[model samples]
Target: MRAVIFGASGLLGRSVVCAFNDMAVTGTCFSRTAGGLVTVDATSADDIERLLSRDQPDVVVNCVGERRPEVWAETPAQARGRNVEAARLIAEGACRYGVRLLHISSDYVFDGKAAPYRPDSLPNPLNAYGRWKLLAEHAVRAACPDAAILRLPVLYGSAQFAAETNLTKIARQVSAGVPMEMDDVCVRYPTHADEAAEVCRRLAGALLRGQRQGAVAHWGAEQGLTKYQMAQLIARRFSLSAGHIRAGEADAASGDRPVDCRLDCHDLPAALGPLRRWLFHTEFPPVVEPWLLPARPVSS
Candidate 1:
Protein backbone atom coordinates (compact mmCIF):
# COMPACT_ATOMS: atom_id res chain seq x y z
CA MET A 1 0.00 0.00 0.00
CA ARG A 2 1.11 3.55 -0.72
CA ALA A 3 1.10 6.04 2.17
CA VAL A 4 1.83 9.77 2.08
CA ILE A 5 2.59 11.46 5.38
CA PHE A 6 2.34 15.19 5.83
CA GLY A 7 4.75 16.81 8.30
CA ALA A 8 6.87 13.70 7.89
CA SER A 9 9.75 15.34 9.73
CA GLY A 10 7.97 15.93 13.05
CA LEU A 11 8.06 13.47 15.96
CA LEU A 12 4.81 11.61 15.23
CA GLY A 13 5.26 11.83 11.46
CA ARG A 14 8.79 10.44 11.72
CA SER A 15 7.56 7.48 13.70
CA VAL A 16 4.75 6.82 11.22
CA VAL A 17 7.36 6.81 8.46
CA CYS A 18 9.37 4.26 10.42
CA ALA A 19 6.32 2.06 10.98
CA PHE A 20 5.63 1.52 7.32
CA ASN A 21 6.91 -1.89 6.13
CA ASP A 22 8.41 -0.78 2.83
CA MET A 23 4.84 0.39 2.00
CA ALA A 24 5.81 2.88 -0.70
CA VAL A 25 5.99 5.63 1.93
CA THR A 26 6.04 8.97 0.10
CA GLY A 27 6.25 12.12 2.28
CA THR A 28 5.61 15.89 2.28
CA CYS A 29 7.46 18.49 4.34
CA PHE A 30 7.05 22.25 4.42
CA SER A 31 9.16 24.68 2.41
CA ARG A 32 12.20 26.57 3.71
CA THR A 33 13.65 23.11 4.47
CA ALA A 34 15.97 20.93 2.47
CA GLY A 35 16.26 17.40 3.83
CA GLY A 36 15.99 15.35 0.59
CA LEU A 37 12.28 15.08 1.48
CA VAL A 38 9.32 16.20 -0.63
CA THR A 39 8.14 19.70 0.34
CA VAL A 40 4.42 20.40 0.54
CA ASP A 41 2.58 22.66 2.98
CA ALA A 42 -0.57 21.06 4.42
CA THR A 43 -2.08 24.49 5.08
CA SER A 44 -2.64 24.87 1.36
CA ALA A 45 -5.29 22.72 -0.29
CA ASP A 46 -3.73 23.27 -3.68
CA ASP A 47 -0.44 21.98 -2.35
CA ILE A 48 -2.16 18.98 -0.74
CA GLU A 49 -4.06 18.17 -3.92
CA ARG A 50 -0.94 18.47 -6.04
CA LEU A 51 0.95 16.06 -3.85
CA LEU A 52 -1.93 13.61 -3.30
CA SER A 53 -2.54 13.41 -7.04
CA ARG A 54 1.13 12.88 -7.70
CA ASP A 55 1.66 10.29 -4.95
CA GLN A 56 -1.76 8.61 -5.39
CA PRO A 57 -1.45 7.12 -1.92
CA ASP A 58 -3.92 4.59 -0.59
CA VAL A 59 -3.76 6.26 2.84
CA VAL A 60 -2.96 9.81 3.93
CA VAL A 61 -1.91 10.22 7.55
CA ASN A 62 -1.72 13.85 8.62
CA CYS A 63 0.84 14.75 11.26
CA VAL A 64 1.14 18.40 10.22
CA GLY A 65 0.40 20.67 13.18
CA GLU A 66 2.30 23.07 15.41
CA ARG A 67 2.69 22.77 19.15
CA ARG A 68 3.91 25.81 21.01
CA PRO A 69 2.57 25.30 24.52
CA GLU A 70 5.25 27.70 25.78
CA VAL A 71 4.36 30.51 23.40
CA TRP A 72 0.59 29.94 23.04
CA ALA A 73 -0.35 33.07 24.94
CA GLU A 74 1.66 35.37 22.71
CA THR A 75 0.77 33.77 19.39
CA PRO A 76 -2.84 32.66 19.61
CA ALA A 77 -3.58 33.31 15.92
CA GLN A 78 -0.58 31.38 14.69
CA ALA A 79 -1.48 28.55 17.03
CA ARG A 80 -5.02 28.41 15.63
CA GLY A 81 -3.71 28.46 12.08
CA ARG A 82 -1.36 25.58 12.74
CA ASN A 83 -3.74 23.43 14.77
CA VAL A 84 -7.06 24.18 13.00
CA GLU A 85 -6.54 25.46 9.48
CA ALA A 86 -3.99 22.83 8.58
CA ALA A 87 -6.51 20.08 9.40
CA ARG A 88 -9.12 21.63 7.10
CA LEU A 89 -6.85 21.66 4.07
CA ILE A 90 -5.83 18.05 4.45
CA ALA A 91 -9.35 16.80 4.99
CA GLU A 92 -10.55 18.67 1.92
CA GLY A 93 -7.86 17.16 -0.21
CA ALA A 94 -8.53 13.67 1.10
CA CYS A 95 -12.22 13.97 0.23
CA ARG A 96 -11.33 15.20 -3.24
CA TYR A 97 -8.99 12.30 -3.89
CA GLY A 98 -11.13 9.62 -2.15
CA VAL A 99 -8.15 8.66 0.03
CA ARG A 100 -8.48 7.35 3.57
CA LEU A 101 -7.21 9.91 6.07
CA LEU A 102 -5.74 9.19 9.47
CA HIS A 103 -5.90 12.57 11.15
CA ILE A 104 -3.70 12.63 14.24
CA SER A 105 -5.33 14.54 17.10
CA SER A 106 -4.49 15.14 20.78
CA ASP A 107 -5.77 14.51 24.32
CA TYR A 108 -5.74 18.28 24.76
CA VAL A 109 -9.15 18.32 23.03
CA PHE A 110 -10.74 17.72 26.41
CA ASP A 111 -10.82 20.37 29.17
CA GLY A 112 -9.22 17.92 31.65
CA LYS A 113 -12.48 18.15 33.58
CA ALA A 114 -13.28 14.54 32.62
CA ALA A 115 -11.00 11.54 32.84
CA PRO A 116 -10.94 8.60 30.45
CA TYR A 117 -13.08 10.29 27.81
CA ARG A 118 -14.98 7.91 25.52
CA PRO A 119 -14.90 8.48 21.77
CA ASP A 120 -18.47 9.76 21.64
CA SER A 121 -18.19 12.31 24.47
CA LEU A 122 -18.78 15.96 23.63
CA PRO A 123 -15.62 18.07 23.76
CA ASN A 124 -15.29 21.04 26.06
CA PRO A 125 -11.83 22.43 25.50
CA LEU A 126 -10.65 24.82 28.23
CA ASN A 127 -7.40 26.07 26.78
CA ALA A 128 -6.74 27.69 23.42
CA TYR A 129 -4.59 24.76 22.36
CA GLY A 130 -7.30 22.27 23.19
CA ARG A 131 -9.92 24.33 21.40
CA TRP A 132 -7.82 24.48 18.26
CA LYS A 133 -7.30 20.73 18.25
CA LEU A 134 -11.01 20.16 18.68
CA LEU A 135 -11.53 22.45 15.72
CA ALA A 136 -9.33 20.23 13.61
CA GLU A 137 -11.14 17.04 14.60
CA HIS A 138 -14.47 18.55 13.64
CA ALA A 139 -13.13 19.80 10.32
CA VAL A 140 -11.62 16.46 9.46
CA ARG A 141 -14.78 14.51 10.19
CA ALA A 142 -17.04 16.95 8.40
CA ALA A 143 -14.82 16.91 5.35
CA CYS A 144 -14.45 13.18 5.15
CA PRO A 145 -16.81 10.86 6.97
CA ASP A 146 -14.45 7.96 6.28
CA ALA A 147 -11.46 9.59 7.99
CA ALA A 148 -10.22 8.22 11.30
CA ILE A 149 -9.39 10.85 13.89
CA LEU A 150 -6.85 9.16 16.13
CA ARG A 151 -6.67 11.12 19.39
CA LEU A 152 -3.93 10.30 21.86
CA PRO A 153 -2.50 11.83 25.04
CA VAL A 154 0.72 13.53 26.15
CA LEU A 155 3.52 12.23 23.90
CA TYR A 156 6.90 11.30 25.42
CA GLY A 157 10.00 9.63 23.98
CA SER A 158 13.72 10.14 23.58
CA ALA A 159 12.94 11.44 20.11
CA GLN A 160 9.73 13.43 20.70
CA PHE A 161 10.70 14.69 24.14
CA ALA A 162 14.12 15.68 22.87
CA ALA A 163 12.41 17.87 20.29
CA GLU A 164 9.77 19.03 22.78
CA THR A 165 10.91 19.09 26.43
CA ASN A 166 12.51 15.71 26.95
CA LEU A 167 15.12 14.80 29.61
CA THR A 168 17.83 16.80 27.88
CA LYS A 169 15.89 20.05 28.35
CA ILE A 170 15.03 19.15 31.92
CA ALA A 171 18.62 18.18 32.71
CA ARG A 172 19.97 21.39 31.20
CA GLN A 173 17.82 23.38 33.60
CA VAL A 174 18.30 21.11 36.60
CA SER A 175 22.08 20.90 36.06
CA ALA A 176 22.14 24.69 36.06
CA GLY A 177 20.98 24.18 39.65
CA VAL A 178 17.66 26.08 39.46
CA PRO A 179 15.03 24.27 41.45
CA MET A 180 12.55 22.45 39.18
CA GLU A 181 8.88 22.72 40.08
CA MET A 182 6.24 20.14 39.16
CA ASP A 183 2.50 19.83 39.70
CA ASP A 184 1.47 16.88 41.82
CA VAL A 185 -2.15 17.21 40.74
CA CYS A 186 -2.12 17.21 36.94
CA VAL A 187 -2.21 13.65 35.52
CA ARG A 188 -1.95 12.26 31.97
CA TYR A 189 -1.22 9.20 29.86
CA PRO A 190 2.03 9.64 27.99
CA THR A 191 2.31 7.45 24.88
CA HIS A 192 5.68 6.97 23.25
CA ALA A 193 5.83 8.30 19.69
CA ASP A 194 7.00 5.03 18.21
CA GLU A 195 4.29 3.14 20.02
CA ALA A 196 1.65 5.63 18.94
CA ALA A 197 2.94 5.40 15.40
CA GLU A 198 2.69 1.64 15.53
CA VAL A 199 -0.85 1.89 16.83
CA CYS A 200 -1.68 4.18 13.91
CA ARG A 201 -0.16 1.75 11.48
CA ARG A 202 -2.18 -1.10 12.92
CA LEU A 203 -5.43 0.87 13.10
CA ALA A 204 -4.99 2.38 9.66
CA GLY A 205 -4.04 -0.96 8.21
CA ALA A 206 -7.15 -2.53 9.70
CA LEU A 207 -9.32 0.25 8.37
CA LEU A 208 -7.78 -0.13 4.93
CA ARG A 209 -8.58 -3.84 5.19
CA GLY A 210 -12.27 -2.94 5.85
CA GLN A 211 -12.18 -3.18 9.64
CA ARG A 212 -14.06 -0.85 11.93
CA GLN A 213 -12.60 1.01 14.92
CA GLY A 214 -16.13 1.86 16.05
CA ALA A 215 -17.71 5.31 15.61
CA VAL A 216 -14.92 7.23 17.29
CA ALA A 217 -11.41 5.83 17.54
CA HIS A 218 -8.77 6.44 20.23
CA TRP A 219 -5.06 5.50 20.40
CA GLY A 220 -2.93 5.61 23.57
CA ALA A 221 -0.99 3.62 26.12
CA GLU A 222 -2.62 1.43 28.76
CA GLN A 223 -1.89 3.47 31.89
CA GLY A 224 -1.79 6.99 33.31
CA LEU A 225 0.29 8.79 35.99
CA THR A 226 0.66 12.11 37.77
CA LYS A 227 3.15 14.80 36.77
CA TYR A 228 4.93 14.63 40.13
CA GLN A 229 5.37 10.88 39.78
CA MET A 230 6.42 11.41 36.18
CA ALA A 231 9.23 13.71 37.29
CA GLN A 232 10.54 11.10 39.73
CA LEU A 233 10.64 8.60 36.87
CA ILE A 234 12.57 11.06 34.69
CA ALA A 235 14.98 11.73 37.54
CA ARG A 236 15.58 8.00 37.85
CA ARG A 237 16.05 7.57 34.12
CA PHE A 238 18.86 10.17 34.06
CA SER A 239 20.24 9.73 37.59
CA LEU A 240 19.15 13.23 38.56
CA SER A 241 18.04 14.17 42.08
CA ALA A 242 14.27 13.87 42.46
CA GLY A 243 14.76 16.03 45.55
CA HIS A 244 15.57 18.95 43.26
CA ILE A 245 12.17 18.42 41.64
CA ARG A 246 10.14 20.49 44.06
CA ALA A 247 6.37 20.52 44.56
CA GLY A 248 3.95 23.18 46.04
CA GLU A 249 2.36 26.43 44.82
CA ALA A 250 5.45 28.12 43.37
CA ASP A 251 5.94 25.19 41.00
CA ALA A 252 2.50 23.59 40.97
CA ALA A 253 0.58 26.31 39.18
CA SER A 254 -0.68 23.95 36.49
CA GLY A 255 -2.86 22.25 39.10
CA ASP A 256 -5.59 24.55 37.81
CA ARG A 257 -5.77 22.38 34.70
CA PRO A 258 -8.63 19.90 34.80
CA VAL A 259 -7.32 17.01 36.86
CA ASP A 260 -8.19 13.91 34.77
CA CYS A 261 -7.54 14.09 31.04
CA ARG A 262 -6.77 10.39 30.60
CA LEU A 263 -8.64 8.55 27.81
CA ASP A 264 -10.45 5.24 28.06
CA CYS A 265 -9.50 2.86 25.27
CA HIS A 266 -12.14 0.20 26.06
CA ASP A 267 -13.88 0.65 22.73
CA LEU A 268 -10.57 1.14 21.06
CA PRO A 269 -9.49 -2.09 22.69
CA ALA A 270 -12.58 -3.95 21.46
CA ALA A 271 -11.83 -2.61 18.02
CA LEU A 272 -8.04 -2.97 18.01
CA GLY A 273 -7.29 -5.59 20.67
CA PRO A 274 -5.16 -5.12 23.84
CA LEU A 275 -2.86 -2.07 23.81
CA ARG A 276 -0.75 -3.60 26.55
CA ARG A 277 -0.25 -6.70 24.44
CA TRP A 278 0.69 -4.67 21.39
CA LEU A 279 3.09 -2.60 23.49
CA PHE A 280 4.84 -5.68 24.90
CA HIS A 281 4.92 -7.55 21.60
CA THR A 282 6.84 -4.72 19.94
CA GLU A 283 10.65 -4.43 20.20
CA PHE A 284 10.55 -0.90 21.69
CA PRO A 285 12.00 -0.75 25.19
CA PRO A 286 10.48 1.33 27.92
CA VAL A 287 12.55 3.92 29.76
CA VAL A 288 13.18 3.48 33.51
CA GLU A 289 10.97 6.49 34.22
CA PRO A 290 8.66 6.62 31.24
CA TRP A 291 5.83 8.71 32.67
CA LEU A 292 4.80 11.92 30.93
CA LEU A 293 6.26 14.84 32.88
CA PRO A 294 4.60 18.24 32.79
CA ALA A 295 6.56 20.83 30.81
CA ARG A 296 5.72 23.46 33.45
CA PRO A 297 3.39 23.78 36.39
CA VAL A 298 -0.05 25.15 35.58
CA SER A 299 -1.03 28.54 36.99
CA SER A 300 -3.66 28.55 39.68
Candidate 2:
Protein backbone atom coordinates (compact mmCIF):
# COMPACT_ATOMS: atom_id res chain seq x y z
CA MET A 1 0.00 0.00 0.00
CA ARG A 2 1.19 3.50 -0.81
CA ALA A 3 1.39 5.88 2.15
CA VAL A 4 2.29 9.57 2.06
CA ILE A 5 3.60 11.09 5.29
CA PHE A 6 3.76 14.80 6.10
CA GLY A 7 6.49 15.93 8.50
CA ALA A 8 8.29 12.65 7.75
CA SER A 9 11.51 13.86 9.34
CA GLY A 10 9.77 14.22 12.72
CA LEU A 11 10.07 11.71 15.57
CA LEU A 12 6.65 10.04 15.14
CA GLY A 13 6.67 10.41 11.36
CA ARG A 14 10.01 8.59 11.09
CA SER A 15 8.62 5.65 13.02
CA VAL A 16 5.49 5.51 10.86
CA VAL A 17 7.57 5.50 7.68
CA CYS A 18 9.96 2.86 9.02
CA ALA A 19 7.05 0.73 10.19
CA PHE A 20 5.61 0.62 6.67
CA ASN A 21 8.93 -0.15 4.96
CA ASP A 22 8.21 -3.90 4.92
CA MET A 23 4.76 -3.48 3.40
CA ALA A 24 4.11 -2.75 -0.28
CA VAL A 25 4.63 0.95 0.44
CA THR A 26 5.65 3.90 -1.65
CA GLY A 27 6.54 6.72 0.72
CA THR A 28 6.62 10.46 -0.02
CA CYS A 29 7.87 13.11 2.39
CA PHE A 30 6.84 16.79 2.27
CA SER A 31 9.43 19.15 3.65
CA ARG A 32 11.28 22.41 2.99
CA THR A 33 14.60 20.61 2.48
CA ALA A 34 13.37 18.58 -0.44
CA GLY A 35 15.64 15.98 -2.07
CA GLY A 36 13.93 12.82 -3.32
CA LEU A 37 10.93 14.06 -1.31
CA VAL A 38 8.06 16.01 -2.77
CA THR A 39 8.23 19.71 -1.80
CA VAL A 40 4.51 20.05 -1.22
CA ASP A 41 3.45 23.12 0.76
CA ALA A 42 1.58 21.74 3.76
CA THR A 43 -0.80 24.75 3.93
CA SER A 44 -1.62 24.68 0.24
CA ALA A 45 -4.41 22.41 -0.95
CA ASP A 46 -3.27 22.72 -4.57
CA ASP A 47 0.22 21.52 -3.73
CA ILE A 48 -1.21 18.75 -1.60
CA GLU A 49 -3.45 17.75 -4.50
CA ARG A 50 -0.55 17.74 -6.99
CA LEU A 51 1.52 15.58 -4.67
CA LEU A 52 -1.43 13.31 -3.86
CA SER A 53 -2.03 12.79 -7.56
CA ARG A 54 1.65 12.06 -8.05
CA ASP A 55 1.82 9.47 -5.26
CA GLN A 56 -1.86 8.42 -5.21
CA PRO A 57 -1.26 6.96 -1.73
CA ASP A 58 -3.97 4.87 -0.12
CA VAL A 59 -3.29 6.54 3.23
CA VAL A 60 -2.15 10.06 4.11
CA VAL A 61 -0.91 10.59 7.68
CA ASN A 62 -0.62 14.16 8.97
CA CYS A 63 2.10 14.25 11.60
CA VAL A 64 2.81 17.95 11.34
CA GLY A 65 2.92 20.11 14.51
CA GLU A 66 4.74 23.25 15.59
CA ARG A 67 6.51 21.87 18.67
CA ARG A 68 8.25 24.98 20.01
CA PRO A 69 6.10 25.66 23.04
CA GLU A 70 8.24 28.57 24.15
CA VAL A 71 7.69 30.42 20.89
CA TRP A 72 4.04 29.47 20.47
CA ALA A 73 2.75 32.51 22.33
CA GLU A 74 4.81 34.91 20.24
CA THR A 75 3.86 33.26 16.95
CA PRO A 76 0.39 31.87 17.44
CA ALA A 77 -0.42 32.58 13.79
CA GLN A 78 2.52 30.54 12.52
CA ALA A 79 1.67 27.73 14.89
CA ARG A 80 -1.97 27.74 13.79
CA GLY A 81 -0.99 27.81 10.14
CA ARG A 82 1.35 24.91 10.50
CA ASN A 83 -0.71 22.78 12.83
CA VAL A 84 -4.35 23.64 12.09
CA GLU A 85 -4.26 25.01 8.56
CA ALA A 86 -2.01 22.31 7.22
CA ALA A 87 -4.35 19.69 8.65
CA ARG A 88 -7.31 21.39 6.98
CA LEU A 89 -5.53 21.34 3.62
CA ILE A 90 -4.61 17.69 4.09
CA ALA A 91 -8.17 16.75 4.98
CA GLU A 92 -9.54 18.57 1.95
CA GLY A 93 -7.03 16.86 -0.28
CA ALA A 94 -7.78 13.48 1.28
CA CYS A 95 -11.52 13.88 0.69
CA ARG A 96 -10.89 15.08 -2.86
CA TYR A 97 -8.58 12.17 -3.66
CA GLY A 98 -10.59 9.53 -1.77
CA VAL A 99 -7.64 8.82 0.54
CA ARG A 100 -8.02 8.06 4.22
CA LEU A 101 -6.13 10.36 6.61
CA LEU A 102 -4.52 9.62 9.96
CA HIS A 103 -4.12 13.00 11.68
CA ILE A 104 -1.86 12.79 14.76
CA SER A 105 -3.09 14.73 17.80
CA SER A 106 -1.92 15.32 21.38
CA ASP A 107 -2.98 14.59 24.96
CA TYR A 108 -2.77 18.28 25.93
CA VAL A 109 -6.36 18.67 24.70
CA PHE A 110 -7.50 17.74 28.19
CA ASP A 111 -7.27 20.25 31.05
CA GLY A 112 -5.45 17.63 33.20
CA LYS A 113 -8.47 17.56 35.48
CA ALA A 114 -9.14 13.91 34.57
CA ALA A 115 -6.94 10.90 34.03
CA PRO A 116 -7.28 8.87 30.82
CA TYR A 117 -9.69 10.89 28.73
CA ARG A 118 -12.14 9.01 26.58
CA PRO A 119 -12.45 9.59 22.82
CA ASP A 120 -15.87 11.15 23.33
CA SER A 121 -14.68 13.67 25.92
CA LEU A 122 -15.07 17.31 24.97
CA PRO A 123 -11.68 18.99 24.62
CA ASN A 124 -10.71 21.99 26.74
CA PRO A 125 -7.25 22.95 25.52
CA LEU A 126 -5.30 25.45 27.62
CA ASN A 127 -2.26 26.20 25.49
CA ALA A 128 -2.05 27.52 21.97
CA TYR A 129 -0.58 24.29 20.65
CA GLY A 130 -3.30 22.20 22.17
CA ARG A 131 -6.00 24.57 20.97
CA TRP A 132 -4.62 24.53 17.44
CA LYS A 133 -4.35 20.76 17.45
CA LEU A 134 -7.94 20.51 18.65
CA LEU A 135 -9.02 22.82 15.87
CA ALA A 136 -7.12 20.71 13.33
CA GLU A 137 -8.80 17.54 14.54
CA HIS A 138 -12.21 19.20 14.17
CA ALA A 139 -11.37 20.43 10.70
CA VAL A 140 -10.13 17.02 9.60
CA ARG A 141 -13.24 15.28 10.86
CA ALA A 142 -15.48 17.80 9.17
CA ALA A 143 -13.67 17.53 5.84
CA CYS A 144 -13.16 13.77 5.85
CA PRO A 145 -15.12 11.70 8.32
CA ASP A 146 -12.98 8.67 7.41
CA ALA A 147 -9.91 9.95 9.21
CA ALA A 148 -8.17 8.32 12.13
CA ILE A 149 -7.40 10.84 14.87
CA LEU A 150 -4.87 9.38 17.30
CA ARG A 151 -4.47 11.45 20.47
CA LEU A 152 -1.09 10.57 21.99
CA PRO A 153 1.57 12.17 24.22
CA VAL A 154 5.30 12.70 24.85
CA LEU A 155 6.81 10.72 21.97
CA TYR A 156 10.51 9.87 22.27
CA GLY A 157 13.02 7.89 20.18
CA SER A 158 16.73 7.53 19.36
CA ALA A 159 16.44 8.48 15.70
CA GLN A 160 15.51 12.19 15.73
CA PHE A 161 15.78 15.09 13.32
CA ALA A 162 17.65 18.38 13.86
CA ALA A 163 15.89 19.44 17.06
CA GLU A 164 16.28 17.00 19.94
CA THR A 165 13.20 15.30 21.43
CA ASN A 166 12.13 15.66 25.06
CA LEU A 167 13.89 12.51 26.29
CA THR A 168 16.83 12.94 23.92
CA LYS A 169 17.24 16.58 24.92
CA ILE A 170 17.27 15.62 28.59
CA ALA A 171 19.63 12.70 27.93
CA ARG A 172 22.07 14.86 25.97
CA GLN A 173 22.05 17.56 28.65
CA VAL A 174 22.61 15.04 31.44
CA SER A 175 25.29 13.27 29.42
CA ALA A 176 27.11 16.56 28.98
CA GLY A 177 27.18 17.08 32.77
CA VAL A 178 24.79 20.01 32.42
CA PRO A 179 22.47 20.70 35.30
CA MET A 180 19.00 19.29 34.56
CA GLU A 181 15.91 20.74 36.23
CA MET A 182 12.65 18.90 35.68
CA ASP A 183 9.11 19.55 36.89
CA ASP A 184 8.23 17.05 39.60
CA VAL A 185 4.55 17.97 39.65
CA CYS A 186 3.43 17.68 36.04
CA VAL A 187 2.90 14.13 34.84
CA ARG A 188 2.51 12.54 31.38
CA TYR A 189 2.76 9.15 29.71
CA PRO A 190 5.70 8.95 27.32
CA THR A 191 5.02 6.81 24.27
CA HIS A 192 7.98 5.41 22.36
CA ALA A 193 7.85 6.49 18.71
CA ASP A 194 8.48 2.97 17.44
CA GLU A 195 5.61 1.50 19.42
CA ALA A 196 3.36 4.38 18.39
CA ALA A 197 4.22 3.74 14.75
CA GLU A 198 3.26 0.09 15.13
CA VAL A 199 -0.11 1.10 16.58
CA CYS A 200 -0.67 3.46 13.66
CA ARG A 201 0.34 0.72 11.25
CA ARG A 202 -2.17 -1.64 12.78
CA LEU A 203 -4.85 1.00 12.44
CA ALA A 204 -4.03 1.43 8.76
CA GLY A 205 -4.06 -2.33 8.29
CA ALA A 206 -7.47 -2.53 9.91
CA LEU A 207 -8.71 0.15 7.55
CA LEU A 208 -7.34 -1.71 4.54
CA ARG A 209 -9.10 -4.83 5.82
CA GLY A 210 -12.42 -2.93 5.78
CA GLN A 211 -13.76 -0.76 8.80
CA ARG A 212 -12.97 2.62 7.24
CA GLN A 213 -15.49 4.94 8.85
CA GLY A 214 -12.62 6.44 10.87
CA ALA A 215 -11.81 5.74 14.52
CA VAL A 216 -10.10 7.61 17.33
CA ALA A 217 -7.42 5.82 19.36
CA HIS A 218 -5.39 6.98 22.33
CA TRP A 219 -1.91 5.39 22.74
CA GLY A 220 0.70 5.84 25.50
CA ALA A 221 2.65 4.14 28.29
CA GLU A 222 0.83 2.28 31.04
CA GLN A 223 2.42 4.36 33.81
CA GLY A 224 1.98 8.09 34.17
CA LEU A 225 5.27 9.59 35.36
CA THR A 226 6.39 13.11 36.19
CA LYS A 227 9.16 14.89 34.33
CA TYR A 228 11.46 14.40 37.30
CA GLN A 229 10.60 10.72 37.48
CA MET A 230 11.12 10.38 33.73
CA ALA A 231 14.47 12.09 34.06
CA GLN A 232 15.43 9.77 36.88
CA LEU A 233 14.36 6.78 34.78
CA ILE A 234 16.49 7.93 31.87
CA ALA A 235 19.45 8.51 34.14
CA ARG A 236 19.10 5.02 35.53
CA ARG A 237 18.71 3.57 32.07
CA PHE A 238 21.94 5.23 30.86
CA SER A 239 23.83 5.15 34.15
CA LEU A 240 24.20 8.91 34.03
CA SER A 241 25.22 10.83 37.12
CA ALA A 242 22.05 12.18 38.74
CA GLY A 243 23.80 14.48 41.21
CA HIS A 244 23.48 17.40 38.83
CA ILE A 245 19.82 16.79 38.17
CA ARG A 246 17.32 18.77 40.27
CA ALA A 247 13.59 19.35 40.46
CA GLY A 248 12.07 22.66 39.37
CA GLU A 249 8.76 24.46 39.75
CA ALA A 250 6.01 23.30 37.48
CA ASP A 251 5.16 25.68 34.64
CA ALA A 252 1.59 25.72 35.80
CA ALA A 253 1.18 29.37 34.91
CA SER A 254 2.40 29.03 31.31
CA GLY A 255 -0.25 26.60 30.14
CA ASP A 256 -2.82 24.27 31.64
CA ARG A 257 -0.80 21.06 31.77
CA PRO A 258 -2.86 18.39 33.39
CA VAL A 259 -1.20 16.81 36.40
CA ASP A 260 -2.36 13.41 35.18
CA CYS A 261 -2.91 13.25 31.42
CA ARG A 262 -2.82 9.48 31.67
CA LEU A 263 -4.71 7.70 28.89
CA ASP A 264 -6.84 4.61 29.57
CA CYS A 265 -6.28 2.30 26.62
CA HIS A 266 -8.60 -0.53 27.69
CA ASP A 267 -10.80 -0.09 24.64
CA LEU A 268 -7.83 0.62 22.37
CA PRO A 269 -6.08 -2.54 23.57
CA ALA A 270 -9.28 -4.51 23.11
CA ALA A 271 -9.37 -3.25 19.55
CA LEU A 272 -5.68 -3.93 18.87
CA GLY A 273 -5.85 -7.32 20.67
CA PRO A 274 -2.50 -9.20 20.95
CA LEU A 275 -0.70 -6.21 19.49
CA ARG A 276 -1.38 -4.47 22.81
CA ARG A 277 1.18 -6.71 24.52
CA TRP A 278 3.68 -5.95 21.79
CA LEU A 279 3.01 -2.24 22.37
CA PHE A 280 3.99 -2.25 26.05
CA HIS A 281 6.50 -5.12 25.97
CA THR A 282 8.46 -3.46 23.18
CA GLU A 283 11.53 -2.42 25.16
CA PHE A 284 13.01 0.93 24.38
CA PRO A 285 16.53 0.45 22.98
CA PRO A 286 19.27 1.00 25.58
CA VAL A 287 20.37 4.39 24.35
CA VAL A 288 20.39 5.68 27.93
CA GLU A 289 19.74 4.41 31.46
CA PRO A 290 16.16 3.58 32.59
CA TRP A 291 15.58 5.53 35.83
CA LEU A 292 18.18 6.88 38.30
CA LEU A 293 18.33 9.16 41.33
CA PRO A 294 21.25 11.12 42.80
CA ALA A 295 22.81 9.98 46.06
CA ARG A 296 22.38 12.10 49.17
CA PRO A 297 25.54 13.44 50.77
CA VAL A 298 26.13 11.83 54.19
CA SER A 299 27.97 13.36 57.07
CA SER A 300 29.62 11.24 59.68
Residue 151, candidate 1: Cα error in Å is 0.7
What value of lDDT does candidate 2 attain over all alpha carbons? 0.74
Lowest lDDT sum, 10 consecutive residues, model 1, at 280-289
lDDT by residue for model 2 (1-300), tens: 788888776678778888888564444455545445556668887778888888888887888788777668788788789899999999999899998788899888888877768877778887778888889899999999989899888877754332356665565556556666778887767778888888888877777666635787788887666767766766676666767778875565445666777776666667766554323123543433332124345578
TM-score of 2: 0.87
Who wins the lDDT comparison? 2
Each prediction's TM-score versus the true structure: 0.85, 0.87
* Model 1 residue 88 distance off true place after TM-score fit, in angstroms: 0.8
Scored by CA lDDT, what does every candidate get? Answer: 0.71, 0.74
Runs with alpha carbons beyond 4 Å of true place in candidate 2: 22-35, 161-163, 253-255, 276-285, 288-300
Which regions in candidate 1 have their CA more than 4 angstroms from the true location?
31-35, 160-163, 166-168, 249-256, 276-300
